[model samples]
Target: MAGRLRVVGVRVERVSGRVAVVVSLGYDGAVVTGRADRATGETQTIQVAAEAVLEAIRQVAPGQTRWGLEQVAIQPMLGGPAVVAHILLEAEGTSEHLIGSALGRSGPLEEAAAEAVLDAVERRLGWFTKN
Candidate 1:
């Protein structure tokens, strides 16, 4: 929140054996991947640094109050650098029901996931650019 509000598209993908939420951060708007679990029509997203995505988790799973960051990476994007924060969940039975409601339904999971993450960031840091 110290800097200007950065907007980058987000993409979420469930690959071979990992669930990743890619985002474009301050660095280069890189892909910030995180592990996810989908079951019973519910999705639970876990990431390192509970504070980073605490808002999203809580929003989806009100009971979720803890998390940790698995990996943090920064990659290059088209115009600017991308920042990717790979997070790890603490529990195994995490839910995925909060996907649509919490994360926006405009794009992929990564984008929605990014919205969730940013939602927390804005709450903690305050709106980057207020109208």
Candidate 2:
């Protein structure tokens, strides 16, 4: 594990009533990409984005504690729509819940979703991404 990872890119696509999200995370010049897809729905975009972030983390840094996305949504806030993410952290006989949010800012909803998930774990990612 290294330090905290940052969202570098997010790509979202909708085709044939299916939604796909890819989240790219950067750490120490290494970029990892995670992907998720589900049938399109009201909140499926955020759901896939959140799941993709967790997938990317697992790809580069395995054998760590557990990280599970509980919920994700984009709702009106801060004068605009904001993506909110709720996550469950499980580690060594302990568990904690974390919440994070980021404004949509007229960007791709997936971008906000990625940032929201990262924000949720910002403070506690020292070990999770430590190099």
Candidate 3:
């Protein structure tokens, strides 16, 4: 586990009291689910891809600069109108090295994982690009 906390992207849907639901979009197209305890500030996230790890990084980068890769696309749900919802996660008890260790291979895996998380975030958050 490294000193710096690792930032991962999780589709935070609902937060009631001390509990919240977070879903991680893996690079292999898998949904890793978890329960976050706000009171204790502990997140027991499921096993996700390197992309998810990158998403976490983007969430808490150094400055205004765009973290990870550009062009995050989040598609809306079909056949229904959904209200925009955002879940703010306080990153603690996790680091990049810790996440990287779980992600297996470094370099490309990290980049791809980041991209995947961003895509999920964009879709979940309804982020759109101006053409």
Candidate 4:
């Protein structure tokens, strides 16, 4: 097994109802980012986005991990409604980065983003397990 993965930072941004999330890991300088569109325009978009991001992190690096969320940013975007997410991850002990993205509504967007991020990380680290 490799060394444990740690989350060093997190950022959540919201514009008008769309959300963008970034998760940074300490090992190998990995960073994962995602976005979502809220159909209900709920006020808890940040929390939701954070959950999605964390879930993504959990999927990629599953055992004996540390979470060090550092930052979160939220704002309004002046544009139409759209949902999209992207992630750039560098697994520990490796130099190459894994990138992924997803597009859809809020619920699907979250799942898609998480899947994309995890898929990239798993491809490199093979640390995740089904749950």
Candidate 5:
């Protein structure tokens, strides 16, 4: 079996009052990066990070499935906040589906954002073992 794709890093920054997130993933010896933008608001960093991770995954595995984010929730953690993301993924040809969720936390907002995305990607990839 092929090795799984895993999120390696995430970077979040504020630009013109908006949030910009970049997500990096590693599979085998290849590295891929995905970017996303979001307006400043509650949990904006987390949202942008998640979107970037999803986008990167799509780029790496275009035929996997179409994904829709269902929910994102944040709770207090020891360092800062813990983000929980729920996503719905639908198969391309059939009606097969899967729900994936992940958790991330960090003292820094940007790192936390990236960690959340990494967690989500790990969980989502578990549903599709082929890639």
Candidate 6:
């Protein structure tokens, strides 16, 4: 185990005439992925990435811990631009907001978006590992 879930792969494909982004996250033994389709005229680039990562997280999360991707965007900042992800965590009648970011130039934007999502949930999901 690498002590946390890592982005195993991120890629885009065309499915049924729609563009889809697939994000895969995994530990050592098992891998899970989620996919989101982009509709025509969609403007937000990272929305599909966020949604795909959220779906992937849900597949491995414990019961009753709901994760929501409120917003995701790429913004310019000091030391180069970055992709930011806003996450909402709801569990046990409590809710917490978390934010994570990754440098946009470090990798492909779709891949960076997935990594940012993992950053947002890393602490919460770190304790759970593959058996």
lDDT of 3: 0.31
lDDT of 1 at 90: 34
Clashes of 1: 28
TM-score of candidate 1 on Cα atoms, chains taken together: 0.33
Cα lDDT of candidate 5 equals: 0.65
Per-residue lDDT tens digits of candidate 2, residues 3-96?
5689999888899989888889998788999998888865577899899998887776536578899999879986689999999988778999
Clashing residue pairs in candidate 4 are 14-75, 15-76, 15-77
Write down the TM-score of every candidate. 0.33, 0.87, 0.22, 0.32, 0.72, 0.85
> Model 6, 8-125: lDDT tens per residue?
8988876565668888888767899898888645745577888899999888887678899899999887866788999999987999998998887856788878888888988876
Worst 10 residues of 4 by lDDT: 67-76
Where does candidate 2 stray beyond 4 Å?
1-3, 129-131
Q: Candidate 4, which segments miss by more than 4 Å at Cα?
A: 34-40, 58-131
C-alpha lDDT of residue 112 in model 1 = 42
Q: Report lDDT (CA) for all predictions.
A: 0.37, 0.84, 0.31, 0.43, 0.65, 0.81
| Least accurate 10 contiguous residues by lDDT in model 3 | 95-104
Model 4 TM-score, 2 decimals: 0.32
Write the residue-wise lDDT of candidate 5 on 1-131 in tens digits: 16666667777778787888888978888888988887787456667777787787777554757766655667676655666666667775654333333434435554554455556556556556555
What's the true lDDT of residue 117 in model 6? 88
What lDDT would candidate 4 get against the real structure? 0.43
RMSD (CA, angstroms), candidate 1: 12.8
Q: Which rank order by TM-score, best down to worst?
A: 2, 6, 5, 1, 4, 3
Worst 10 residues of 6 by lDDT: 122-131
What are the per-residue Cα lDDT tens digits for candidate 4 across 17-110?
A: 5666655544345545433335446534544554456554654555554322222223223442233333343334434544433333444333
Give the number of the best model, judged by lDDT. 2
Q: Compared with the true structure, what per-residue lDDT tens digits does model 3 show for residues 5-121?
A: 323344433344343334343322333333333432443222123224444444434333242322222223353221221223222332121111112133223233334444334
